[model samples]
Target: MGFRENEINGINDLNLCDGEQAVNKTELIDHIATSADISKAAAARALDAMIDGVTTTLAKNDSVTLVGFGTFMVSERAARTGRNPRTKEEITIDAAKVPKFKAGKALKDAVN
Candidate 1:
C-alpha cells in the first residue's frame, strides 16, 4: 500500500504492508513526546541529543552500548580493487571507517 504524508498520525497509524511501513523522524518525535509526557520540542531535542552522542562516540572509533537496545561502533574497511559498473574500469576502493550497529539480545527478542 502507498503511504501519504497526511495519513500518518503516529506510529500506530502506519500500515505495515509487506514491511513497507516506515517511521520518519517527525513521527518518532511525536511518539516520544506523547509517551514521555513532554513537549514536541523537548522530544526533538532529546532525540537529537541521543543521535549526537552516538555520532560523536562513533567518530572516536568507539562504541556506544545501550544495554537493552544495541551497540554502535565504527568498523574499518580494507582497501580493495573494484570494477566500475558503467565503464568496466578497474579502480581501487580506499579503506575507510564506517559506522555499524549490532542489536542487543533484548532488542532482538522484542522484534521476535
Candidate 2:
C-alpha cells in the first residue's frame, strides 16, 4: 500500500537533512515490509523488537552495535544549574542518562 501526499494525515511539513522529506514511523514500517518481503505486521514486530532490545541494553549501561549500521549507547549528563530565560530565575537540572547513536563508516558512506 502506498500513500499519496494527500493521503497521509497528521504529519508535519518538515524538511529533514539534505532537504529530504521526513519519513515517520509508519512509512519506515512500510519500507521494511516491502524490502524484506514480509507482512506489515511482522515488520512492525521486528522493528519493535529491535527498539526494545536496544532500550533494554542501554538501561543496563551497555551498548548495542550493528557492525556497519551504528552503535546505540548511553551517556551521563551531569546535573547543572540553569536559568529561566524569561524570568531570569535559577533552576536545577538533574543529572540523567541519555541515549545516543553513532553511525558507522559504512552507513555514513552509503548516505554520502
TM-score, one value per model? 0.82, 0.79
- lDDT, candidate 1, 37-107, per-residue tens: 89999999999999999999898888999998899999999999999999999999999999999999977
Top-lDDT structure, candidate number: 1
Off by over 4 Å in 1: 1-20
Provide the lDDT at 35 for model 1. Answer: 68
Report the Cα lDDT for candidate 2. Answer: 0.80
20-79, model 2: which lDDT tens digit per residue? 566678877877786678999999999999999999999999999999989999999999
Which regions of candidate 2 deviate over 4 angstroms? 1-20
Best by TM-score: 1
Residue pairs in candidate 2 whose N, alpha carbon or C atoms collide under 3 angstroms: none
